[model samples]
Target: MSGAKLVQGNEACVRGALAAGCNFYAGYPITPSSEIAEIMVRRLPDAGGVFIQMEDEIASLATVIGASLAGSKAMTATSGPGFSLMQEHIGFATMAEVPCVIVDVMRGGPSTGLPTSPSQGDIMQARWGTHGDHPAIVLAPSSVGEVFDLTVKAFNLAERFRTPVILIYDEIIGHTRESVVLPDRVDIVDRSRPNGNPSTYQPKAPAANGVPPMVAFGDGYRFHVTGLTHNEHGFPTTDPGDTEALITRIHDKVYDHQDEISAVEEFMLDDAEVAIFAYGIVGRSAREAVLRARRAGMKVGLIRPLTLWPFPYAQVADVAAGIDTLLVAEMNLGQLIGEVERAVAGTTEVIGHLRADGEPITPADLIAALPDPAGART
Candidate 1:
């Protein structure tokens, strides 16, 4: 605790969760993500927190939601398959406006594809895993250190927005061990608690930021919470006006604050003609490719979205406007590339370098994908 230590990405997540005041963890063991649950079990109680291993992924998420409603910052961790199982509860958390965090350490999958290997196939799933149209905040971290930092940010965002936040890590990052200097102090944000009389409190009353103040159950504040479209008082209502207001508020809470919620790390975009847009582990390789390309006198840059959802359209568009060609590298078969293409909208040529063979994309692979600098026009 005094000096830098070698830590795995999954362990860093537990440390970050503890730093963020996470007091409850409920999860089922799944490969790559199993370490997170193991660490939480060992650490949570020592920090005066609670940890429970539920029967299944679905029950794990449900328990997490229950803990959040009971006034605790709660979380659950899982891999691709478990994530698939928790989709319904994730939507429930969104609809009920529950504040919690979900960590998905991605592995290859379309149904248990590769348990111990890395993949970015869940990029789109993180955005659209749930059934309905709702806002989502998904953060993808590329390094062990980032895994720690972003997990804290995920919890903060969850509390601030009053919704579930996803922290995504691929198998490479989750299992890889690296020396990391843990920060002595980190910024923590707690959910906004209601201040008015309990009897008259409207649990679903919209705040200026489009997030309503939340009160835990048994806080002397009696209120209803249901997945169904509810009114301002937290009751199920079929009223068209009330339904519209609730749904619209949920969407705007994150989308309207896109600038603040979306974070991107841009590498050497100034005067660049070609760009590589990547995330998760692939972004790490893209960083190396940019450095190597620059050393070789090629105007190449990298755009890594630390926040994957809300898609970082504005940032990507700004960078895309100046570049002639953009290459999207990922472990999936062109999931994020489609978003880059949509954001660029023919202003620049968008290409994808994808691999789903349970291997990490390499810098050489990315460099080879770059357009010829001499032949390409800016």
Candidate 2:
């Protein structure tokens, strides 16, 4: 396992979490994502970490939050239905500013719709399911190697921002095995700890970086943690100014760091007139489709986003400005395409190659969605 081992995407995630200093895992096993929990149960203890099999996804994230507050880098893995169950806690984590990671290996779902199938139906849910005006950091990796990389990045983002970060991929990517030479070490970011007098500590007071320094509950720092609108002291408050400041600060912490948090991979886009905007497993298909379109003398390219939240609007707008058309391919029916259209802002024609029948979008499907070569160029 030291060099270029063939690893499933879910396994890579567990390895990356461990590499990122994740010392706690709490989750209920579900299809596609179960391997992550299964591997953690065996690997975490060996790495001097703790693993708990919770009764359900809700409790899974709750345990992760507690562990994180107790100074452990914690995470949980689940699929669509389980993800739905965890939304309330996700919001609580966001409001409480708890640092944790949640891996959602997506399956087809409105209500346990397809358990063993692949679908990108949760794209919007990852950002909006928790409700209210909240900040979100969600990463989607297309390949096994990238899965490892982004999982590590997810932890770093969570710890740096003091918020929950989600790493999501479809069933295909989760179960697929690929040879990857994972790095022996990766840059890890831990939550900033308070160094001043514990008595004067304000749990919700942010530093210059817009993130509050955290002190573990057992570290002799006494501070209240609640989901209600609280001031810098972390106690519940109903004052208009305090409530507004609290919400705005949380959202600004992420938006202000958009440059560091947003990641997108543009493939052969400089001279291209037509672009494919895809992510997750569909991104792989889009990559192949771009190559095929190039072989056929078409100016095709790809915009594969590694970071799903914060939308990468500027990146998409820059690409859209120069392209004649942008094709959005996803496993769901038009979830993120609207975002693309909004970014495009009518600068170029936007079209969707969508599927939600528990099937993966293939290269041919993306290729077919492209305009003919003769009409593609502006």
Query: Candidate 2: lDDT over CA atoms?
Result: 0.94
Q: Give me the runs in candidate 2 sitting further than 4 Å from their true place.
A: 373-378
Question: What does the lDDT read for residue 157 in candidate 1?
Answer: 95
Compute the lDDT for candidate 1: 0.93
- Candidate 2, residues 1-378, lDDT tens digits: the string is 557788999999999999999999999999979999999999999999999999999999999999999999999999999999999999999999999999999999888889999999999999999989998999999999999999999999999999999999999999999988999899998899888998899999999989999999889989898988899999999999999999999999999999999999999999999999999999999999999889888999999999999899999999999889999999998989999988888889998899999989999888888999596422
Residue 188, candidate 2: Cα error in Å is 0.7
RMSD of 2: 1.8
TM-score of 1: 0.98
